[model samples]
Target: MVRILQQKQFVGHEIHGKSHKYYPLITKETYTKSFMKGFVRRYFSGSYRQMVSFFTKEDNLSLHELEQLLKELKDKNS
Candidate 1:
C-alpha cells in the first residue's frame, strides 16, 4: 500500500515506522480470488501465451484449469 503525499521538502516526515525512501506509504486493498486472477492477467499477463507458461511453471497448474480460472476471472470483471 501507499500513503498520502506530503510536501516535497528537503526532508520528509518520519514517525518511527511510518515510512522511508523505498517503503510505500499508501494502503493496499484486498481482492477476491477470481478478481485477483483477472487483475494479474490484465496487468501482468502480457499475452495468453505467457500466462500459460507462468501458470504451469509456478505451480504445475494445468493449462486447462488455468483457462477455466481465466474465464471465471473475466466473468467477475464483467
Candidate 2:
C-alpha cells in the first residue's frame, strides 16, 4: 500500500525506528474527483448522463432523490 501510494506520489511518510507514519499529499475531494473521472470514462464512455441514466434505470433512487439531483444540475447550469 505504501509503495503504491509512493509510486502515485499520493503520500509522504517518515520512518522512525521500526515504525512509519504516512500523510496524504492530495486532498480527499481531489482524489475522489480523480477516481470518479477515470471510472466515468471507463464505464460510461466519459458521459455523466449515461452514468446517471444507468443509476436511474436501476430504480436505486427515490423520487425525492431524483428531484434533488435535477435541482443540483439546474443550479450548476445556472
Candidate number achieving the greatest lDDT relative to the actual structure: 2
Please give the distance, in angstroms, between residue 25's alpha carbon in candidate 1 and its true position after superposition.
1.3
* lDDT of each residue in 1-78, candidate 2, tens digit only: 888999999999999899999999999999999999999999999999999889889998778898999999999999
Please list the C-alpha lDDT of all candidates, in the order they appear: 0.61, 0.94
TM-score, structure 1 vs. true: 0.30
Estimate the TM-score of every prediction: 0.30, 0.89
User: Which structure among the candidates has the greatest TM-score?
Assistant: 2
* Pairs with steric clashes in candidate 1: 1-26, 2-25, 2-26, 2-27, 3-25, 3-26
How many clashing residue pairs are found in candidate 2?
0
Rate residue 73 of model 2 by lDDT. Answer: 93
Model 2 spans with C-alpha error above 4 angstroms = none
State the lDDT of candidate 1 residue by residue for 1-78, as single tens digits. Answer: 223334322233545666455433333342245456786679777466676677689987987888898899899999
lDDT of 1 at 25: 35
Model 2 alpha-carbon miss at residue 60, Å: 1.4
- Scored against the true structure, residue 11 in model 2 reaches a CA lDDT of 96
Clash count list over all predictions: 6, 0
Off by over 4 Å in 1: 1-13, 16-24, 29-45, 57-59
